[model samples]
Target: MQQATPLQARVEGGGTPTMANWSLGSEAGVLKDVLLGPPEGFRWMGLENAAWSSLVRDTLRRGYSFDKQLAMRQHREMVSAYEDAGVTCHFLPLDEYNPYQVYARDSSFMTPYGAVICQMANPRRRGEYAACLRFYLERGIPIYDMVSSGNFEGGDFNIIGEKTALVGYTDHRSEEIAARQVAGWMKDEGWEIRFAPIDQFYVHIDLMVCMLNERCAAVCLETTEDDIVDWLKARQIEIIPASFKETMALGCNVVALGNDRVLSTAGAKDLNTKLRAAGFTVYDPDMTMFTWAGGGVHCMCQPLNREAA
Candidate 1:
């Protein structure tokens, strides 16, 4: 509740953050050059990431898993979706890490300077980032720090801009450190961070908020705190409201596909309308299954390289 400090208020003229200056969750560490699709006949049972959540569940019958054949079919669909969006995907061969990590949530949170690989919030998911150790090392991504406390999920933090970030959780599912830790880390990076409250109703900041462009962002005002709103307004950010219904359907979980173009779930019509009006190019995929699992576009893709604009 203190006034914005001079350090917090300082801005480097508002630019995109470089990958070296970022922290990323490691599970989704599969590199784009080697990203893999699910195998045939393998129905994903339970996906921790909501964007792929439903597909993992609904792709099969109860008390059963998708065999190799079905898994490959599911993978084809996922690959097709990304290709349709003009995403240049690279698939790595399968390893102990499996496909959950390919989504990059387990890799590390990316800031403007370096990477922060997250510790798994789920015991079963621990050490997934370890699988990508070679990938980061070979690529020259630096590890400035790491999370050693209770479980933390990188999906929960949303970087609204170069100087600001939003963090929160949905249930204790993801520790508050995801928010608090990221905020503190960014503070050292000279960033102004804010913690927002998320519920099972909205799992992460990405579920309720997204940056569509340099000057425009989308969020469901109903779920965000007033402080976040005021902070964003002060930065000259244009607020596009996503309805509660849209938020639930993971409307705000958008991925900037680059060039002011993005990918989102098909169900967020109202939010999409606002985005189009804001001069954005929005693309939708067959996200009915993913939305049901509680994640959408943003959850599906882990961006490895985003050149600052």
Candidate 2:
């Protein structure tokens, strides 16, 4: 019989052991497996949670209608794109109460050592963690630790490269105290952590910045702080600027499939063109149903096993 993976794999005094089966050192790696949320129960959070995000607020303000069929179709297209890119897709068990569970990247994120289960800020979405916990436990994936300091979502945790991370927090969704707590844990694991403090309106740091490869990143200069830009440059990373207009549309929020390929949205025409011009194979899928609800390709899925960069 095979030994079962522990629920918590993090070491008490630091130096947590890395995963031998699942390897992911950076966001730019070639993805092998990905975790995606189910779209079956998705619905607009409605006026009750309009203040949840600017995008959702705008969607309501525009009187946009919710089409479950269209949303599911878009999700299938997205999954097809990933499959075409040679990625295996894993879906979280459907939960009727957690409509926003479609945004899988928000509940938990993966790390070199294991997966970190996050504490969600929104009361309606807190139950999302239960699904995440069950998925990891069933798959034999180690749980590094759970966030208890404060509310901190997975989107705020950005892995730039091996042993380097950029942790972000908006006092609203992700608190500074929580970000510091996560940073401290990674620091003990010998990681260089950079703190990114941004406005709550932007939601998460990934809205304006995402690494395309080890040597390149797509960023929205207007929304991203100067210090963050300088930090990326300091590491000798080439910048691909996405217009603020596009970034607000969730265009800048993209997924790197490694091997000079990227998964972006059709609305992100400018960035897609630029990426293709830069010698990248870009998969442009129409995801208006999700993007208008406040997430994009990057926000909908979480990479599980990735080839080391």
1-309: candidate 1 lDDT, tens digit per residue: 743212122123433244433333221121222233223212233644433233234333243432555434444565665676565664323455444554454345555454566766555456556644545555565554566665556676677666667777654546675557656766765776677775654555676677776667787899887888888899898888988767766778776655667666567888777778777776765555444533465765556555454
**How large an RMSD does model 2 have?**
1.0
Per-residue CA lDDT of model 2 for 1-309, tens digit only, reads 988778789998689989878987899989999999999999878775666688889888889988999999999999999999999999999999999999999999999899999998889999999999899989889999999999899889998888898899999889999999999999999999999999999999899999998899999999999999999999999999999999999999999999989999999999999999999999998999999999999999889999977
Residue 22 lDDT, candidate 1, scale 0-100: 36
> How well does each candidate superpose onto the true structure, as a TM-score?
0.72, 0.98
Off by over 4 Å in 2: 1-4
lDDT (Cα, 0-100) at 273 in candidate 2: 94
How many clashes in each structure? 57, 0
Q: In model 1, where is the ten-residue run with the lowest total lDDT?
A: 25-34
- Report the Cα lDDT for residue 257, model 2: 95
